[model samples]
Target: MNFKIFPALVLAAAVTLSAPVGLQAQSDDPAAERIPIMRSNGMVLRAAPRASGDEAIAAAQTFVDNFAALPALFEDPAFPGNTQPAAWDNFDAFVGIFDEARQGAEAALAAAQAGDMNGYSAGIQTVAATCSACHGPYRRQ
Candidate 1:
């Protein structure tokens, strides 16, 4: 057999053999559904800094709403790479952080509605801290 043709044939065979495994691995990843939610959450976070008055209130409300659902999402058995039993040791704590974030967001919303920039700034800070606290311990770097 010609060497060039032989290499091409071997490459094709290898790809065909690995295709199912690759597909299966992709299917096994549980983050696919969660990525969009994360992106939406990011959009709300990004908007918060630029928004003021009603816009800020709206953004904060959106942030609170998204985080409110996180506990249920995180509790899902199919939550991305959350397969290891040890990963769930602090599951309740992780969920609790979202509650804290929701409260922060609510405070931000109230401050925005009242046109209190100082309070809004403080509320935003609280929300950010909550995110950092949870991510530091639970999220993959």
Candidate 2:
């Protein structure tokens, strides 16, 4: 097997292994669920560069769905490590950023459906920037 494909295969395996199974009860902590979702998002983003039009559209749609759900997850009282008053403030700001990213992902999905590769690229860039902006201040190192 080509070494170039090896790492991708490993990553795919890791993601598959880490994903929550339907038979297993997930943690009540939002962070526990969020970690795997974020890892899957990274996988989709990484694959987007090489994906075909249909694949890109599917990936973008998944991103849109995931980001749309993020605000509720972040706002959940059971979300881990968000007990402080300032954390709520930070979460509010992060929600705005997440909304922006969701919009970007939606745009990417539209662009893919419309066969506009350039628009899709730009949308992906916007989404990436939004993620980085939120992570810079909020994500635990």
Candidate 3:
């Protein structure tokens, strides 16, 4: 018997027995109930910033990604279990910031495609504004 498989089998049995009808697994389920606002922010930063080659645009993208990835430093199960992070508690606080970030990303991508460095710069700044807006509230010291 494969020892590696044993853990999976046990986990499955535990899930089958303990899980409620509507309850979902966080890791296995594709539509797991993550904070959508946070996800959108991440997408905006990662996808939109790459749309341009301008230094400021790239810097803005890098800032958001680096900051957002910080939460995973605590939340990722691969890390040792620790206290819950603030992001988990303040999911709604950053929704507006993410919305703005999304728009900026869209604009940047469009500008980058059009070879409009000015547009790209403006879009990246817009995205950075969003990230900064949210960070002002929930970001830690």
Candidate with the greatest lDDT versus the true structure: 2
Each candidate's TM vs. the true structure?
Answer: 0.68, 0.73, 0.41
lDDT of 1: 0.68
Report how far residue 112 has shifted in candidate 3, in Å.
Answer: 0.6
Shift in Å, residue 11, candidate 1: 45
Q: What tens digits encode model 1's per-residue C-alpha lDDT throughout 26-91?
A: 344435544555666667777777788888887787667666655555555556452344347867
Q: Model 1: residues >4 Å from true position, as ranges? A: 1-31, 82-87
**Per-candidate clashes, comma-separated:** 0, 0, 0
lDDT of 3 by residue, 1-141 (tens): 999899999986874453232223244422232334345446555655455465435444443443333333333433322223444565444444555665676676566656787888787778667655755655553
Q: Order of all candidates by TM-score, from best down to worst? A: 2, 1, 3
Model 3 ranges with Cα > 4 A deviation: 1-93
* 2 or 3, greater by lDDT: 2
Of the two candidates 1 and 2, the one with more favorable TM-score, higher being better, is 2
The local distance difference test score of each candidate is 0.68, 0.73, 0.51
